[model samples]
Target: MNMLYLSVRQGSEKARIWQICDELLARNGVPPSGREVADIYVAEGGNQGTGFTQYSHWKKEYLARQEQAAPREAILLSPGTVTFRSMSVTADGTIMLPADIRRAMLLDEDGRVTVSVVDGELRVISPMVAVRQLQRRTRELVPAGTLVSDELIAERRQEAEAR
Candidate 1:
């Protein structure tokens, strides 16, 4: 998955801050952590040099890399909720989601879903789709004795023959 950092310029409005956070959450399916948010800072004038320049420079560099590395779209999720279907882990321990799932969920290419491992169980961390389509073969191959009545089956056969 992708990691994004948002930095606000000096004198940025509170609404903008909230908006950016909301957008990030919606696009990434998770809220940025305290550390991530804290990393952002405002800059002072060039003459003062009160660490603003350094922070600004770092922000620029980080933004450039982020823009280039990140996907065009970003997925956002609600607070305290994680969506699992949108994320996966690679062999190299990099967190990511499959391309098809990303596309279907409208998540950014670089966006990631959080994952956690505990008690020998691997869990995907997200609020992905709960219902999946059953395979056609599985649906067609209903076990015997599970049917409430054979009338439906007979009707299906008749319809097939008619076609």
Candidate 2:
């Protein structure tokens, strides 16, 4: 999974960002402190200093770090969409993927999938597969929906039951 530090402007500390992060943290059942959440914003290029000059430095450092990190992309989705790609589901049910990859999936704020990226290529997956995978992986830390197709799901299910 990719780790991204998103920075937000000091003035952008509104309810939307907070709501999303809160929901995300709550879904994972790991409450993050304000400082920790602030850290992500700082990493994303947010100004952390009290004054203008210090804030400028923080922004510079954040940008530099982003440049050094792996490239990532985000996909924006309209409201009322559903389903996304599931890269890998862990034993503990934590769905892991690069933050950029998640963004590339273009899931809307409601966690609905509007797009998907597979092997660095963007394509749409069937809604059935998407939903089933999501249902199976809902307990995951960061569910990315389902990527496997119906045939694969059937085969995997059979294999699991056979064991």
Candidate 3:
């Protein structure tokens, strides 16, 4: 997100800047760290350090927003994905991921993912996984709760079983 700078006339300017940054992060996925952007801003623009200070404050707010999502997104794991396995984290913290699995996930440079530790194994997942898992419980994906007839539900369940 572009940092807000040089317009010191308004009282709610800081909040406005932070909301923009929050939307930017959500749209583009989290960066390596918020500080890196601010550091680059100063390096490129030669502005006084106020931008860095503003970013530091916004980073805390952005991170808090991320934290707020954790609980709401929690899900009970499927039998297969919950199985135990061993893994080793690389020195630089990369975990080896299978190409087929990565392809199935459709991961991209700007994509965001969720990681879980299940029985000592690394579980990197797409947000769709949570929605699907919740579907098992609520039988609906959208919060508006579209009604599904029992016959249709049973037919779909049978079809899923056949697969």
Candidate number that wins on TM-score, 2 or 3:
3
Pairs with steric clashes in candidate 2: 2-98, 5-44, 6-44, 7-41, 7-44, 74-103, 75-103, 75-106, 93-140
lDDT of 3 by residue, 1-163 (tens): 4433223335454544444455556666753233454454456553436544565567555445555656633422222233345667799997765644544564423345798898996667765455556767785543454455765899999999999
Q: 1 or 2: which has the higher lDDT?
A: 2
**What 10-residue stretch in candidate 2 is worst by lDDT?**
72-81
The number of clashing residue pairs in model 3 is 0
Decoy 3 TM-score against native: 0.30
lDDT of 2 by residue, 24-106 (tens): 45566543434454555567666543223333334334445545664532212211243565576589955544545444443
Which ten contiguous residues of candidate 1 have the minimum total lDDT? 125-134
- Candidate 3 RMSD to the real structure: 16.8
In terms of lDDT, the poorest run of 10 residues in model 3 is 74-83
Clashing pairs in 3: none
lDDT of each: 0.44, 0.46, 0.52
Candidate 1 residues 10-114, lDDT tens each?
A: 444433433434455567665443223323423212222323334334433444555576763442221223345555667898755456545464332335455
Candidate number with the higher lDDT (1 or 3): 3
